[model samples]
Structure formats: C-alpha cells, structure tokens
Target chain A: MNLKAIWWKLFCVLLLIYVAIAGLLSPVPRLNILNETIRNLYFHVPMWFGQIIIFTVSLVYSILYLLDTNQKNASSIANSKRDIAAHSAVTIGMLYGTLGLLTGMIWGNFTWGTPWSSDPKLNCTAIGMLIYLAYFVLRSSFTDIDKRARFAAIYNVFCYVMFVVLIFVIPRMREFSIHPGNGGNPGFATYDLDSAMRLVFYPAVIGWSLLAVWIWTILVKYREIKLFWNMRMNNPLSAVALDQV
Target chain B: MQAIITLIKKEATIEWRNRSVLGSLLLYTVLTVFLIFFSFRNLDPLSWATLFWIVMIFSSVDAIAKSFMQESQERWFYYYTLFTPGQLILAKLAYNLVLMVLVSTFTLLLFSLFVGFPIHDIGFFALALLGGVVCLTVLFTFMSVIAAKAGKNTALVTILSLPIAIPLLAVIINFTKKTLVVQNAVIYSTDIVLLCSINLLMIIMGYILFQFTWKE
Candidate 1:
C-alpha cells in the first residue's frame, strides 16, 4: 500500500486504542471516589470541547471566504480552497455535535433520572443543532452552485453567533436548571474535579480534535477527487489541467 | 432620518398588504388566548400566568417567522433595496415589535376578561409585557433571518427559535407571576434585571450579526 494509506491506518489504530484505554481504565479508583457515574465525563466533556473547536474553525473559514470573495485570485484555486475548508468544518462540526448529544444523553440517563429532560442547557443544544441542520437544508434548496456556497457561508456565520448566545449566555440567566452549577444544583463549583479526572479529560479532548482533523483531511481529498472527476467528465480537455496539479 | 422612516413605512405597508400574513397572525393570537383560557378554566392565577406566556411565545414565533419569508419570495426586489442590512433589520424589528406589543395587549386583555383573575400590580404587568415584547421582537428578528435562509416552514423555525426564547420566556412568566399574582417587586428584582440584560445582549448581537446573514 501507499505511504499515505499506511499512515492513515496506523493513525486509526492508535486512536481506537487510545480511546478504549482512556475510557475504560482511567476512571478506576476514582470510581470509588465519585462512583461509576464519573465515567461519563470521559466521553461527554471531550465531545463538547471538540464541538467548540470545530465550530471555531468553521467560523474562521467562513470569514476567510467572505474576504476571499472580495479579493482577486485564480478562480479554481480560490474556489477549491474555500470549498475544502467549508466542507471539512461542517462535517466535523456535525460529528462533534452528534457525539456531544449522545454522550450527554447517556450521562443524563444516569445523573438526571431520565435520558432527556427539558433542561435549559439541553434545550439550547437541541436548538443549536437544529440551526446547523437548517444550514445544510438551506444549501440544498439552491440549485446554483455559487449561490449555494455564498448563502451557506452567510448562514454558517449566523449559526455560530446564535450558538454562542443560546448555549453560553441564555442558560446562565435562567433560575430553573437541572444541569449542574446553575439553578440550585450543587455543581462543579463545589466538587473539585480531581487531578486524575483532568489527566484523561484533557487528552480525550486533544485526541478527539486530532481525529477530527485527520478525518477532515480525508474528506477534503475525497471532495477534491470528486470535483476533479466532474470537471473531467464535463470537459475532457480540463482533465489534463487537473491531472498536472 | 427620512430614509429610515421611509423604509420602515414601506415595510409596514408591505406587511399590511399581505392580508393573509396579518390575518393569520390575528387569528392565531386570538385562538391561542382563548385556548389557554379554556384549558385552564379553573386554574389558579399563577397557572393562568404561566399558560398565558407559553401561548404568547408560540404566537410570537408563528408571526415573526413569516416576516422575512414574504420578502424572500421576491428576491429581486429585496436585493435591489437601497438600505443596508442594518437598516432593513431595524425596520423589521420596529415593525414586528409594534405588532407584537399589540398582539400581547390584545391577548392579555382577552385573557383577563375570560379568566377572571385579579391583576394585582397594574404597573408591573405593563412593565412585564413591555419587556416580553422587546425580548420577543429582537429574538424573533434574528430567527426570522435564519428561517428565511433555512426555507423550512413553521416546524424548523420553532425548533430553531424555542430554545433561544426560553430565558426570555422564563423571565416573562416570572415577572407576570410577581405582577399579576404576588404583587411584589422585591421578590423579582433579579429576574427583571436579567430580562433587561438579555434584551440588551440580543439587540446588540442581532445588530452585529444581521449583515452576515442578510446577504443575497
């Protein structure tokens, strides 16, 4: 196999092993300290952290796209770069968001007495996900390629802003929260997250983020290949130009 | 000044001309108020206040989501406007805020009449209504831009809007309870401050972000 394929396989194996070890072994004697429920933090906190990192990357690309559109560049190079960034961010953001929701649901099932409740934090996350889902639907509604990209970038930026307000600001203001730390629940403020918890939590976040970037790179390559094929099929002469790159 | 007023007037006129939009908004508002009254025919004042704000929140979503959809349908005209996005948003917010206040007033009046609850602090109730209307208008304006771009109808808008609206809804309900039932200001000072802060934050954030999403 090619060197690139070998590297990707190795990376996947390493990631799987790391996640398993961290998830299964790290919460050991601490289980006696905080109970079996503390185990959920291994998955839940990292998913939320990964989501924020991906969304921050998405916003940067969106701002870059707006700036690029106003500047002069080789049309193909500019479009390709912007498309890669935009598509990668969306894919990774969706993954992080999905995992975050799942992990939170799992954590909730044990901690909050039900898998899901209308807690303010939980509700805000649901809304944030819907906003992003609408971003995808908005892209699909437009037939023209350029219009779709432009509109999607604009909507993506809006979603990011709304995400900040809904998730960060709104929940803190309310007096009725089932989530820890707000509204009368004795939260993280009281219980010190031990050094042991931090060890696994930090690495889990880094590992998940790196995994996101690794997957994003593969997806970008796939997109480039697909675009190249489309260009070739549409005009055989253009195929030579792409192949040279 | 004149140009802004003209834009506001033009938007208001267009909104009025869309008879179906206004008609539905009015009908929905009236129906929701009546439903709340019917559902809690014998509930206490606190329950009545809670049900009233819940209905208002949903009604606000219904009316505001359509605010931009009508303009989006005629893309060419919307894009050809001389005003910047900030101006357009301002106009939309002003128009919607007026409509929302009127709707809230009508709903509350009908609610008071049918439910036969004693309103303890008239001034606090008015303040609560004003705060609720401001919060709803700013939040809905932002959501309208999102819904306009999303192009999914009512369900999508609700999913997008309901969460953002919660803090405001909570404050409104709490304020109403304090005003219409408890008749105490000292109990809800913090809630009032939080509601005002949310309104301020939403307006500033919505203004800053409007141009990004308003692009044609």
Candidate 2:
C-alpha cells in the first residue's frame, strides 16, 4: 500500500484507539447529573459529526450526478459511479446517524430519565432518518438502472435540502429544549469543553468522520463489484473473454 | 409567462372536465373531518391545529399526487415538445396551490362547524394557512413528478413528501396555534420569514431539478 494513500487511515486508527483509552480514563468535570456520562461527548457527539460530514459528501455526489447528465460527451460509467458513491455514502451516513440516535437514547435514559424525549434535535434526527429511508425505497421501486440512478439523485438532492432546513427550523420554533446548545442551556463548547475534553473531542470528531469515509469507500467498491459481477453473469461470453484477458 | 398561464388553464379545464374528481377530494376532506368530529367531539386548540394540518397534508397529497399521474404519457410527450419542464411544473404548482386553498378552506369551515372554530385571530390564521399551502404545494408537486416518473407509485408520493413537509408543517402549526387565542398572540416575524424563504427555495429547486427528471 502507498504510504501517502494510507496516512489518514492510520491517523483514524490511532486517534480512535487513543480516544477509547483516554476517554474512559480521562478526568471530566464532576458536574451534577452529567457526572461520568459527560464522557459520552467523546462517542455520541462524534457520530453526528461523522454523519453530517458523510451526508454532505453524499449530497455533493448526487449533485455531480445530476450535472454530469447534461453534458453531451459525459461518460455513463463515471456518472454511474457517482450515483453509487452517493448511495453508499447515504448508507454509511445513515448507519452513523442511527448509532448517534441509539447512543443519545442510552445517554438520555441515564441523564434525562427517559430513553427519549421530544427534543427538537431528536425529532429532527428521526425525521431525517425517515427522509433517507424513503430515498432507499424510491430507489428500489425503479427497474431501469439509469432511470433509478437519475430519480434517486434528484430525491437525494431535494431531501438533503429539506433535511438541512429541518435541522435549522425545528429547534428555532421551540425556544427551549433539554439538549445542549439550545434554548437557555449553554452548549458544550461554552460550558463543558474545558480544554481536556476538547483534546479528545476534536480528535474524535476527525477520527470518526475519517472512519465514515473509509467505510463509504469500502461500500462503494463492494457495490461496484457486485454490479460488475451481475453484468458478467448476464453475459457469460464477456466474462470468459475478460477472464482470458 | 403566457405559456405558464395557458398550461395552468389547461390544468383547470381538465380538472373542471372531471368535476367528480374535485368533488371526491372535497368529500374525502369532509368525511375525514367528520370522523375526527365523531371521535373526539371536542379538541383542544393544539390538537385542533395539529389535526387540521394532518388532514390538509393528506388531502393535499391525494389531490396533487395525481397532477402528474392523471395526464397520459402521450399528452406529456406532446407537451414535452411544446413547453419547457419548468413551465409545466410551475403551472402545476400554481394549480395545486389554488386547489389546496379550496380544500383547506372547506376543511377549516367543517372544523368550525363541527367542533367550533377556536381561532381568535382569523386574519393571521389565514396568513399561516396560505404559507402552509404554498410550501406544501411546492414540495408535493415536485415529489409527485418524481413519483410519477418512477412508475407512478402513488403511495410513494406521501412517503416522499411528508417527511420533507415536516418543517413547514411544524412552523405553520406553531404559528397557527398562537392565533388560537388573542392573549398568547406572539406572531414571530422569523417564522413568517422562514416560511417565505422556504417557499422561494422550494420553487427554485423544483424548477431546476424538474429538468433532470423531465429529460428521461
């Protein structure tokens, strides 16, 4: 493997290992209620940062897919890959998002005394999950590859815009939520960071986001190979000729 | 502009020709509201706002989902040669807006008639309704096109539109709830601006994105 190509992967691995060890053992502010669970900031918060990073990457790929379609000399293979990238990114992003939700729920149970509350951020995450689930369903309903790719890209773009608006709009509607950084409560940045947590928090965010992209690359490659295998199976002669080559 | 108007006129004439379709939509609204009236008998202002928006969302989906589906492919092919996709979508959006206005007004009247209108500031409520209708119409109209293109899976329309419509519906519901009483009336200008900006964004997005969907 190329040293240059694998630097970030190595960084991601090192940072995450450091986080796992240092997160549990590190001293945190002995605040009431939060107490030891304040350490969740290292894990739970990074899931959202990772999810948003990957989702933004996915949205960009979707836009590129749409834009590439307009050019007369555009390569269909590249366009298809863009669609696949967008799809895979969404899959991984959703995985991170679900993890974020579950982690938040577990933390909320211990802290807020319930598995879930009607917090704006929580509701937004739930709705955001639904929108992406619909994207997958919409993709599945179409039979033609090109048509499915195009339509899914369109929905991906539209859904991203709305998801972002929901993220901003919902919290503003209700002035108070139990979540940090919203309504009266000071965000983690102000009250909780305290330099030591920031050491782990920033690295954890970067590490998790890099890990998401790494997983996304693996997913894209798997899907691409699956597509290639399907194409070959449909044409045994092509498979035989390619095997000879 | 003239082309858009003509296309909207064409939509109106088609809806007028199938009068039963419009009547059935109204009947759907009335029956749903009647069901709620029977079940609840009395609703608090919050529930009233919520239920009203729920009915509006579903009925709007039912009404607008067919906007693209009702037209035959041959007619679309013909229009494809005549008008741009942007013109066609804008026209459909305008027509759906008008249709939703009628449906929402009818639903509001039925709610008042059955459960007693609780809205104190009627004029402000109208503004919120218009805002909700415009956003819902814009988003659903585009989603319907995507649904129609993807083999006209009409159920896909609701699944696709409802989640995206959450923000708009949330703001409108909150805004309308405030209008239910004269004393708690704090009509935040930010919400109104949010709705307007969202409407503008949806319109621009629909116009741009429909071209890709229209191409194939």
How high is the CA lDDT of each candidate model? 0.71, 0.86
Docking level for model 1: acceptable
Candidate 1, residue A83: CA error in Å?
A: 5.1
- Candidate 2 on B62-93: residue-level lDDT in tens? 99999998877788889989998878887888
* Highest-scoring model, DockQ: 2
| Candidate 2 global TM-score | 0.94
Worst 10 residues of 1 chain A by lDDT: A26-35
Candidate 2: which pairs clash?
A: none
Q: What's the iRMSD of model 2? A: 1.3
Error of 1 at B43 (Å): 3.3
Q: Candidate 1: where are CA atoms >4 Å away?
A: A1-19, A30-37, A70-84, A107-113, A117-121, A171-197, A231-245, B15-21, B72-81, B117-119, B146-159, B182-189, B213-216
